[model samples]
Target: MPEAPPLATEHLTRVVDGQTLVADVSIEVRAEEVFVVFGPSGSGKSSLLRLLNRLDEPTGGTVYLDGTDYRTIDPRTLRRRVGWVPQRPTLIEGTVAENVAWGPTLRDEPVDEARLHELLDRLGLSGFADRDADRLSGGEAQRVAIARTLFNDPDVVLLDEPASSLDAAAADRVESLLADVMAAYALTAVLVTHDADRARRLGHRGVRLHDGGGVATGSLDALLSG
Candidate 1:
């Protein structure tokens, strides 16, 4: 039998004040696969990513991680296993290594230097351990942010348009970096994006979040044609 997917959602809904940002949306993300969430602006793509990560509470429905209800787990523990990379990453005042080691070190877990080098090399940031994070380009900063999140050793990564703010060259770099990172870690990822082409290119499956309580999900081809 096939292994159960790493993540799935059932009728997830989120409402802020009187506004319902995300309607009932459901999806199943296979283990080590990239699941893309595509939508036009104001379609709640960001909202859905937040709900999946439990960064924002849902008004209704449930989230499952490895067939276990996520709500049953403590929020902090859940977050460590499910890291988030935002549209605009925030870099602390420190060297790249310091930012990457912050999480595990904070948790009192010894940072793995070899593994750190491996990840930095993979992200094209090798020998940049001592580089000031504040001076990195948009793409470089995002890569550092991703490497930092990886220090937490998350099984699933949530990306809310990590490449959206970058220029074409930088965006391509970030996109390639994401693909490499996922492959290296065999991670399951949910990426929210306004670029349908990106969704088709990187996602194993894709979903389009409509304005109301409607969602259209299917293979990448279907998403591109919609």
Candidate 2:
């Protein structure tokens, strides 16, 4: 028998007010690989990520993390394990340190300062620990959001248009940081993006969503030509 995938969605569907946003999305995300999800504006890529974390319940189908259905687990506990980072990160009203510490704090776990600093170091946020979280630039905020998610030691991370709002330079820096962290931690992730170039640079398996039916394909050149 084969080992279970790190993340799997089986015939997933999401509907709101009789409108179908995502229909029958099924895919297996392998371990330690970045799986990019690309599609048009209303292709339901974001909806799929929300369904994986159970932030939005699927109208039908199942999301399995490590082969166990997510619906059977506590929502809060599942979220901590399966972290989601939005395009525009939302930080709490406090210093950067406080925001990063919030994750472990929720579980009554003592802050792991060494590990925090280590992850912050990777994110270029070592010195900004005591700085105000609200004072960060667009790219810096995204980096901070990523570091905060890492603090919880999540098994899987979901990224929705992670660098959609950043400039070229800033976005490149953020992507570089992610590549480094993902490699170092061996993290498994699914990222939603409209940029085929960005998806190519990330270099992984991918799927394109159209009308909720996913095409199991991704090749930078092919995507660019399409």
Candidate 3:
């Protein structure tokens, strides 16, 4: 029998102050694959990511993680299992290690030093553990932010314009880093990006959002070809 997908949504909708941000969007994301969310600004690409992560409440519909309704799960637990990295790197005022270890620390769990180092190394930030986070460049800080999310050992990772804040070179680096990390962890990922080439390179399948509704869903190539 085929295993259930790690994540799925049914008739997901989100409205804010009479504005519909996401409209009845549904998708099943296969395990260990990159599921791209591509669209123009204000199309609810980020809104969908937030809904999946439960950062924002949906006005209607449902989200499932591992065949269980996400709303039934504790928000903190759900967030830990399904990690999130925003469009911008928001490192706390502290060392890189502190930021990376923040997640486990919140739950009174002991930070795994070995795992922390592993994540930093994977993100190409080795030897940066003790470095002050504010001192790092955009690319480096973004890498740290990624490592921070990974430290939680999430089953799925939601990235909202992860590289949008970086320059061309830095964006490429972040993209490469994400691909490598996803492979290393065998993670299920949902990435929101405006770059069509990026969607093709990283996504096996995807959905394009328009006016908070899903306009297309299929193999990335076909979705982006138009």
lDDT of each: 0.87, 0.87, 0.92
Model 2 worst lDDT run, 10 consecutive residues: 216-225
Instruction: Give candidate 3's TM-score.
Output: 0.97
Which residue window of length 10 is worst by lDDT in model 1?
Answer: 206-215
Worst 10 residues of 3 by lDDT: 103-112
Off by over 4 Å in 1: 1-3, 212-214
CA shift at 84, candidate 1, in angstroms? 0.3
For candidate 2, the C-alpha RMSD (Å) to the true structure equals: 1.5
* lDDT (tens digit, per residue) of candidate 1 on 1-226: 7666788888999888889988988889988888988888998888889888788999999899888999999998999988999999898888999999989877888889999989999998999999999889889999999898887889789989999999999999889877887887898888888897788767898788887354688788877686
Q: Per model, state how many residue pairs clash.
A: 0, 0, 0
Cα misplacement distance, residue 20 of candidate 1 (Å): 1.1
- lDDT ranking, best first: 3, 2, 1
Off by over 4 Å in 2: 217-226
TM per candidate comes to: 0.96, 0.95, 0.97
Q: How many backbone clashes does candidate 2 have?
A: 0
Scored against the true structure, residue 8 in model 1 reaches a CA lDDT of: 89
CA RMSD per model (angstroms): 1.4, 1.5, 1.1
**Model 2 Cα lDDT, one tens digit per residue, 114-177:** 8888888988787988999889999999999998888888889999888888999999999999
